[model samples]
Target: MVIALPDPPLLEPRVLGVEDFATKRGRKYGTVLVNAESHGVVDLLPGREKELVAS
Candidate 1:
């Protein structure tokens, strides 16, 4: 069974923190968006698409 998670709330991060991490060694990767000011997690995006994150 597939469970769909609701999309994270849209936030205008005052201080954006962008980072990339490996999900599987030499296989897959994902990006994490954070609010640098509040130190809160904004969103976790799957995949390594440069354009997606650039925007």
Candidate 2:
């Protein structure tokens, strides 16, 4: 018999660190959102407008 383990729950961050940078060609922009407590990258948004990053 085989048993499957349940997936771990996701962590919710109270504080987020956001960073924005441009591609080498300067044609696209990328944004990174990190969890302050864990210091882990939570999300990455590429080729997105500045407004989206701010929001």
What is the TM-score (0 to 1) of candidate 2?
Answer: 0.66
Model 1 lDDT, full chain set: 0.83
TM-score against truth, every candidate: 0.69, 0.66
The residue-by-residue lDDT of candidate 2 on 10-50, one tens digit each, is 78999999888889888788889999998988899874676
Q: What is the per-residue lDDT of model 1 for residues 1-55, given as tens digits with 9 covering 90 to 100?
A: 2367776676788889999888667599889989998888888888669987886
Model 2, residue pairs in steric clash: none
Q: Indicate which candidate wins on TM-score.
A: 1
**So what's the TM-score on candidate 1?**
0.69
Alpha-carbon shift of residue 3 in model 2 (angstroms): 16
RMSD value for candidate 1: 5.9
Q: Which 10-residue window of candidate 2 scores lowest in summed lDDT?
A: 1-10
Separately for all candidates shown, the number of backbone clashes (residues 3 or more apart, or on different chains) is: 0, 0
lDDT of 2 at 18: 88
Worst 10 residues of 1 by lDDT: 1-10
